[model samples]
Target: MINNSKILLVYTGGTIGMIKDFETGALRPFNFDELLQSIPELKLLDHEIETVSFENPIDSSNMNPEYYLKIAEIIEESYETYDGFVILHGSDTMSYSSSALSFMFENLNKPIIFTGSQLPIGDLRTDAKENLITSIQLAGLKKNGKNVLSEVGLYFEYKLYRANRTTKINAEHFQAFSSLNYPALAESGVHLDINEAMIKKANRRKKLIVHKELDNNIMVLKLFPGINENIINQLISAKGLKGIVLETYGSGNACNEDWFINLLDKAIKNGILIVNVTQCIGGSVVMGHYATSTRLEEIGVISGKDITTESAVAKMMYLLPKELSSKVFKTIFETSLRGEML
Candidate 1:
């Protein structure tokens, strides 16, 4: 129990933020007051907890760049006042939202833990209470006068992972997310065990710089065995398109057809940055590793390394508005900014 630490809970709507009305059995948004009442254990935690929520709670499917900006604004405005932040978001898009925020904040020196539950908070066997409680506890964690976690993390079913390194893999299980490429930062059991060696320590010497400009003029094109050429042609021609996350096959291989290569080549020449990320959930994109992928590397395709598609999309959105040159963007995209990649 960290005493005197202030933890801010930002509820941007999710099953975790819903409580069933006992009388009518209808789910309604749980206000901060009712939140305390529903989970009395929150009161037992020694930290000073404050909460803010979206006026109109929305499902995770409705999450977008605009909402990402809104969430960042909330944290930016209160960054100096709070010790840490725990965002209660829908698990469906938690990885994306968390990844986007990881890039939005530069040089963050405080915990930003994103968490939500598969079941509503009001359910009898809900996992919400534990998720919410432990997230707050993690957010308030401190060691030798410094915050324990300084990067964006996603905590669920007792495991804490770097936010951008995560993906929601299950729909019905309590453990709905997984970070296959990276190890868990912490695990909750009899004791909250944190992997100090794995944590991303913040550079406190630098002040936090929040980046609010995000361009969503990007699309993710997942390649399959028989993905049509016309589909590729139309997608590249999307108006004002700035980037594309090409979800390639094993080790970033894609269709070897000349038409496929030419279409992408044209897009790159027209100033669209295409990043080659592995479609497989748990591996790195090593472009040029295979004969099929050799041309992708030769044609200026940026390798996403081991980044998750969610993070790749978030990274693309974050970088698109920066107006970096094709070469510089490739260098930066391939490099790790927030521990999002290897």
Candidate 2:
């Protein structure tokens, strides 16, 4: 006997939560309590929908670790009661928020799908309706009487991707995100086609654990022509800075200049962790592959492999506060813990 699944809809603020004011012709947040009134198609699904929204909605730019903790707390409080979760978020930084949540929840066994739209739900041609309707349907899918998607993921533009692997690529296009080094977990057309082989399998016996503590003392350094030592020193020398995401050239190459090496070396000696992530969108960072990168390898820079910037940031936040030794940090950063890297 198949029982109807209960899905929790968490609206964390985005175009999907907005509506156009008739007189002002401007967009404003909609009351999700009236969800069925706006998208009645939801009533046709075979699942029960419950909603929770932020007391005061926040834009994607304002999203932070505090919000991530709040979201995790909600899921933790209702974990056993719900079969799955669907998060409505702003598109601009949805990838970052989703990536952070991926790390926050360990040993997850239920689907937590994050999605949003490029246009407000109230718009006549809004993408929100289809996105919301499909996301709910995806959340309720089951295999062998258990939730089908057992990991964190992002559903957008007709494709579902591993949340930690995705990066938003456009602001104007309806198809706004891409998983550079990974394939879509599912696709929606006339019928939803799930790539079962690509879905992550969870450990059924391990209890879900939510990690709320995240360290925000991290920086991102991008290498470019004419970037002076003074600028580098200013950023690397900041007070209490603990981690850095170094966006290097192709294959993780960077200027082999003495001053640059000296600066990085000094930071490493002071216990600051530096991760070498490639600036290229579609390739992995292969440290020591070339003479130029061998110097970075010598100074304890950890290669991020094929991890995206969003995942790198989230990983640093999750790992930095654990007080792991520099050696341990290097090992963990290089090791693919959640399928975020190659």
Candidate 3:
């Protein structure tokens, strides 16, 4: 058992690490080594800190599965040395990246908290410092001599949420993230009060497992009222498409037309996994609750049960390579692998 908490800060680039040029007033990358220098308050935190940076930090729009593997490998390599980890990432794809990491590691016994700011750390009223500082505090949290957060989480705007349950909901607001279907695991108040009951405690008896095989041959098809068969067929039959996150109508409803059902059924029979997620930000996909969605349930569509689009993509990428049978794939997709869904 580790007695002391040590945190490793992983920087993967984002607005949090950017600074505006005094002359041109344009944003540019700042040296991550200066992180502590920028936030001297970090020296006041309880835990010892170490930092690492990617060779090249790209914008979150450039984030992909390869980067996800690199992040996972870094944590795996330092797993034993560090008590917990905090990843500084771009808020644009933070949810997707964080959610992917949640699935990559099984039986994680420490906090891997992801945080970033809507404004640059150098800004007058930036959210970066507080987010980073408090995330470290949460990472170092222990109870009865055991780690508190033994799961991946996204900490932003004073709330720490299950990573897989988060979504980047706003671009201009300091509160850019939201975990609608789930309660926050911890909230940073004057006292840093944690929701003890909401934390996911891991069984330390189990060894950590890292999964690297993420297959990205999947697509998300958002349903619209007038979506035509031609576009549906084109999307379903895309070359090398292995799975589809069908963003269905409310309550998992879809067009009751024969062509739509036939198109999806044929795709399913062709070894394609189709998972149903509601387009709404809130609410679960209760397929048979409505008459329009009954055929979706009958046709073997897997319910996503209120998972965010980012998480559904991450889950698909992680699970597509396992080559589970179509039935097994459906069963597992409906089940919550991480705390991604209800």
The lDDT of each candidate is: 0.92, 0.92, 0.89
The CA lDDT at 129 in model 2 is: 90
Question: What would the TM-scores of all predictions be?
Answer: 0.98, 0.98, 0.97
Clashing pairs in 2: none
List candidate 2 segments past 4 Å from native.
1-3
Descending-lDDT candidate ranking: 1, 2, 3
lDDT of 1 by residue, 108-163 (tens): 99999999998888889999999999999999898877898998999999999999
Candidate 2 residue-wise lDDT, 101-205, digit = tens:
999999999999999999999998899998998888888888779888898999998999999999899999999999979999999999898999999998999
Model 1, CA-based lDDT? 0.92
| Lowest lDDT 10-residue stretch of candidate 3 | 1-10
lDDT of 3 by residue, 155-265 (tens): 999999999998888999989998889999988887776787987878889999999999999999998889999998998899999999989877888898999999999
Residue 330 in model 1: lDDT = 94
